[model samples]
Target chain A: MTAPRLDRGQRPDGADFPDCKRTFMEFNVLPGARAPYGIRNGAGPRRAVAGMVASTYVSGAESEGAYTLHMLTGAKGSGLPLLSHSEAHVTLYVLDGALELVLDGQRYRMGRGDSALVPAGTAYGFVMTRARTVLMAYATATALDSLLAGAPYDGFIPAEDDATGPADLLKGDFPGTTVLGALPEGTDFAEALTTLPETSVPYVLEAGMGERLLVADQLFTFVAGNRQTGDQYLSVMTQGPQGDMIPPHKHLLHDELFFCLDGAMRLKAGDELIELAPGDFCFVPRGTPHAYQFLRPFTNMIGWLQPGIFEPFFHTLGDPTELTRYPQTPAPFRFDRVIAKLDELDIVPLGRPPEAGA
Target chain B: MTAPRLDRGQRPDGADFPDCKRTFMEFNVLPGARAPYGIRNGAGPRRAVAGMVASTYVSGAESEGAYTLHMLTGAKGSGLPLLSHSEAHVTLYVLDGALELVLDGQRYRMGRGDSALVPAGTAYGFVMTRARTVLMAYATATALDSLLAGAPYDGFIPAEDDATGPADLLKGDFPGTTVLGALPEGTDFAEALTTLPETSVPYVLEAGMGERLLVADQLFTFVAGNRQTGDQYLSVMTQGPQGDMIPPHKHLLHDELFFCLDGAMRLKAGDELIELAPGDFCFVPRGTPHAYQFLRPFTNMIGWLQPGIFEPFFHTLGDPTELTRYPQTPAPFRFDRVIAKLDELDIVPLGRPPEAGA
Candidate 1:
């Protein structure tokens, strides 16, 4: 709530932010939302291939898609085609340098703050080698009709296990960010736009997957990213103090904000144990009871809700990769009749802080 | 009214025209305003004395005085560094190429849609010759204060009347972008920041001049630019079906949204003309008495109310060497007494238009 001066203090209220007279697609009035009818920048593609530069500013989008941000410069080193998808659940934030997230064939070097998961159909490849600049926020996207529920999976792939051709749905290049046997198995999404590389296309923003969450660098994307317009997309996840402990728990529906930007954040929510820093901020609303930890070393910014793309609970951590405790049951959509459907949408989560022997 | 799709469509509710991730500075962000800020590549000192390639995204910001969006790309016959400033009021738009400006010593060129005004003390310089790209918006300035009512004039020079070294502001750059021009009898103002150019310095974003009426790209800035949150920035200037005139008009409290991004737009407002097209959208608000013109070739996207930093009525132009011809008259702030103080903040306009000679 601070925005009033429009330039009166003797100068500088916006000299001008550009519009040298026409760019291209211009419209988005902002009330709640509406943007998706674009062919986007491949502007003119026939195919020449390599010059690539993928994602660059991915911060949590709204919850359903949790903390999503993308950024990838030019395309040095090499190795990038291959793709597949069932729906997202990713998380890879590395701001300002370093890359090599291979997965499926194995590579992983990631830098900055490191956090990874590439589930769905598995088949990924990223090689920047050095010229790095990253941020990738993909929380939940489970809905492929509840993720291929009946199973059988086959969005297409038989034409003799295809090999290449057809793919540029706005730019999927080798089946998007690639990985699927690297390529050769009925391929065909137009061979992911014949290998991409005309340049420009990129920029595909979407949100959903429990809504999205990732505090420290402001990846609070979609505090409620939309079950259909519940509106929520606040990103600031700077990858701060991930001192990781997360012991306390409570969430009847959802309520939180833990706004810290580096070191300091104890937040027990509800009855309060607060303890914030870096310009502080807190709330954790809903049925109240909450949980969080990281004192000796911290990095804050939380904001919750929006299906919270917990991505099937972090893909159950690559299938029980040593469950770090905390489970008295309660974690599949954590429903209690959806807490009376989120207190009729007023949302309510004010519980958990009085525990240490309340 | 259409962005719900979050992704069964994979992604497409952002970046079609996407820009407002939280922008108050950085070229500009007013379609639903959202500017996030942070851009750097470097240059400025005669654009690095003159190798050029500068990049600044936006300037004059920080809690107050904010308005700056610069982008200078060079290569072919480079140019930039013949500056001038004093009192602000500088505007230049042309996004992906075409600029030759020069000023005071004369030259002009510009491209895209074109708009030039560098008054305050004049003496500019751009010259990209070709590999160009321009989108400069200034603010918190004083130079063209609606054509200097505070008076001062005469082509500016006295920064020391030409003593050699240091005054390149950008080649033949004396007190570049000047303002007021006092002290021929000596010179002062703290030696004008020891010879300016630490990116010029000055920060503050929203301080005064609010009350909305901003629409860039066919120009029309600050009307209700937020007058501290009274809210109302309208636009819509259409015309067709053998009808569209708007010659005389008044009412500047702020509010107008002519919309119609492509055809049909027989607008007028006060005397009535109406018609609008495309996704349609009208408001007018404030005291009303609008204006518009277009018997055929339509494309409306107005939305202007007033936000400040568009040189209070473009330095009330009268001659920056001449080119003028827009709406003019009603200078410094007057349009139905600022629309009667914006009808005590209720805001209205877009009263009639259901069809019939609309």
Candidate 2:
């Protein structure tokens, strides 16, 4: 029998590039790709908390303490108990399946793509009503890390024999969090929304319910924008058809992140060209040159920009509309509009690099 | 408190498409995107088998009993005992991290991107030597499904207190499988290969050591091809730069599946457009019009085509090359050459549709 041959690449670990210190300035997360600041789907520090698998994506350290992003995945019947984060502003956005959200004792059933924001100290819990459900939780402060940092959980479903109680799982010294036991039984769930609401005390936006704007060929639905979050951050959902969407540009203020919810996105960050899949993430710090291309139909993405200074970039250029999604035939993009506001918006466009792979 | 508004889209589930019968002809899988045949990453039937979390990606039932694909992820020290599949030819390809493989009494150390094929009834086992290691196992028949179908494993790492022994975990009547206890200790590992080997009995190819070819702007590396598997299937790795890489075309002879390994891929299958992220999968059956574009720098994808009759499509159009990765500057694509082989290759070119979003 002939001996097997194994090719060793440049790196000792057979990685293409030598290990470099993680700057956290720019990062990409995809399968087999590692980033100091992000986690790929299915591979992260995970924990079985309350009945769901919580996977930490962006930790406080990775984000330089700006915010933390974690994904909560659970099957039907799995859920979180009522709890309050005294200091963290928690944003829960459902990606798939349905969720019953109990916020401040008022129940609401959230379907796919629904989102809610619970400000500091507001109690909330959720129950998965559908299987293979996914929820993304972004906290303005570290929330799940202190609870999930130990050994990784080995399974996706909690064992039937698991004897650990809520008290045991809630044993961390995280001052902001307060567990309020299980969801109340026999409570009536609030009626589903029909159109986007004018305003609510504690913000909640159902699927396709948001401030809609047509910017170029893309539709921007700001689930949580400057007015919604009190200038904390901007959380928006974008969907559009395929094309080279923008020129290379840099933000002088505010770090931004792109979390792909669906479709395909090709992004250029600094000198690196990256493609984002569903659940993939790319972080571009301020001053880093970046551009994005929607490469396929219905390329959907979620953007989280910190400090909420750039919300006007969309509002200033886009025409506010009632359409929930981009039009079948979109209006031509006005590049001149973006060019006119570049300096005022802290956007510096770079001349396109020699055509890629030329 | 003001009442909220939820935009109820055309579909009751808030999905873009109305429920349609799954024809198993074309499917796309990314985050939130569901396929009738494939499982999204982190969302599939799973089992804790031999200390690793085994996730079923493409089951035999989904593949029409032709083959099965599963992903095995483990932490350091997690592994399988020597086992043999009597009826299934198992191919193990490492996506990330390192693994110690014991094949027919010989131990081999495999790093990132390494792969080995264990033919039917060949005893093989593996131990994860690095943390967060992931291995993709593709079998010529149903192998892991019969082993991992009970329930989803609740965690990423196995529980320490679990009492289920090997015999208990291996109790299924899977005719082909035979467990051989734990890996033997004190065994020396074979040295890694520096250069590509001429040939081996049971095929093994390390990362960057496959049969390399340059077709247009993309680099095609055949880890397992027609000759390698006796015309069973062709497994290839492709990397290229950003561009509209190909015209809309249909394959008349083979069913192909694309799994995004790294970077971004925008694929058009029939009328649907899809962007594949890492771990995302898209399956296009024969006679379906399909096209693909690499939308970002270093967009990488792994493709599996069954009953491999189309290996010549690449070999005929590509020049043999020594380089392992796509070059910084690629040779321009010869579309005329592709036009020349249109009928011979069973490729029917469809004129591009109107520019997207026009």
TM-score of candidate 2 on Cα atoms, chains taken together: 0.48
Regions of model 2 farther than 4 Å from truth: A1-38, A147-150, A154-172, A192-200, A352-358, B1-358
Reproduced native contacts, each prediction: 0.00, 0.01
Residues B129-231, model 1: lDDT tens digits: 4322333333333222222121121111111121222223323322225322211211111110111121212211111111223211122322122222122
Model 1: interface root-mean-square deviation in Å: 26.8
Looking at chain B only, the TM-scores across the models are: 0.28, 0.80
Model 1 chain B worst lDDT window (10 residues):
B187-196
Q: Which ten residues in a row have the lowest lDDT in candidate 1 chain A?
A: A36-45
Candidate 2 per-residue lDDT, tens place, B1-358, comes to 1111111110123132222221223332322222323333433456776656676667775567677778786655666667887677767787654678988778886754677877777778777765345778887777666755544564333433333433444455554577766777655767544343443246556554578888655788887776656567878888765555376777777777777776556666665655555666766767777777665444678887876788877876688876555654455555566567767776677764323211
Candidate 1 lDDT, A1-358, residue by residue in tens? 1121211121112222121121122111111111211111111111211222332121222222333222232223332444445545343433323345555444554433333444545655454433212233333443211211122211111111222222222143222233343322321111011111222122112111122333221122221222222222222232222243343445444334444433344554443343443323443434455555544211334333334333233222122211111111212322333343443443333322222210
Using TM-score as the measure, which candidate wins? 2
- Poorly placed runs, candidate 1 (over 4 Å): A1-358, B1-79, B82-84, B89-94, B97-130, B136-251, B254-342, B346-358
Q: What is the lDDT of residue B146 in candidate 1?
A: 23
The local distance difference test score of each candidate is: 0.30, 0.63
